[model samples]
Target: MFGDIMGMMGKLKETQKKVQETKERLNTVLIDEQSSDGLLKVTLTANREIKSIHIDDSLLQDKEQLEDYLVLTLNKAIEKATNVNETELAAVAKEGMPNIPGMDAFMK
Candidate 1:
């Protein structure tokens, strides 16, 4: 029993390490989103950090319109980034998890 516990502990530690590595790797994965009219664009990392924003000159003339476009585009970009981040981390975590009978359900 103690041996099994020790093995599981090791696996948990390894999984933690892999999770951290995956998070670091996500920083390099980029996601781009733009407004429906293509006048506003936003880029984000899979880690959900905003990388850049590009707005058309026309948008600069209408502050309210620009804010609306930014909010919408940024939200979409953030959603995409969150999905990527979760999927990648979940894959790594599931792969590294030890065969603990009930844990499979939780992973799913």
Candidate 2:
């Protein structure tokens, strides 16, 4: 029983290291989103860090429109990034997790 516990501890440590590495890798994964008319565009990492924003010249003329576009576009970009981040991290975690009884349901 002690041997089993020790092996599980070692596996958990390895999993922790892999999770950190996966998070770092996610920083390089980019997610792009644009307005329906393509007037506004955004880029963000899977880490949800804003990388860039591109606005059309027409959007500059109307502050309210610009704000609306920014809100909508950025929200979409963030949503996509969050999905990617969660999915990737979950996959890494699930893959590395030790097969503990009753933990499978929680992981899902």
Candidate 3:
């Protein structure tokens, strides 16, 4: 019985370490999306921090069109980053969830 308890504790510690590592790595992961015409581009981290933007110089003369392209590009980048975030969270879940007395039944 004591050995079984120790084994479970070891598994729990390993899972916690993996979860922490995944979260740290997520901040460094980059996800990018561009407008359909490729005039605008946006890059963000997997954790949704906007890192950079690129816009064609030709669009700068027209404020309205520039705004439209910016919006479209940003939204696409956000969507992509969100999908990446979900995937990362799921990977962490597959690693193992926080240990609780009775949560395993519900999590599975």
Q: Tell me the TM-score of each prediction against the true structure.
A: 0.94, 0.93, 0.72
Global lDDT of each model? 0.94, 0.93, 0.82
Per residue, candidate 1 scores C-alpha lDDT tens digits across 1-108 of 999999899989999999999999999999999999999999999999999999999999999989999989999999999999999999998988877789988987
RMSD of every candidate to native, in Å, equals 1.1, 1.2, 3.7
Q: Which candidate is the best by TM-score?
A: 1
Clashes of each: 0, 0, 0
Candidate 3, 1-108: lDDT as tens digits: 999788878877887788778778988999888888888888899888999999989889999999999888888878888888888777676666545689767755
Error (Å) of candidate 1 at residue 30 is 0.1
Candidate no. 2 TM-score: 0.93
Best-to-worst ranking by TM-score:
1, 2, 3
> Rank by lDDT, descending?
1, 2, 3
lDDT of 2 by residue, 1-108 (tens): 999989889988998999999999999999999999998999999999999999999999999999999999999999999999999999988988877799988987
Count backbone overlaps in model 2.
0
> Candidate 1: what lDDT?
0.94
Colliding pairs, model 1: none
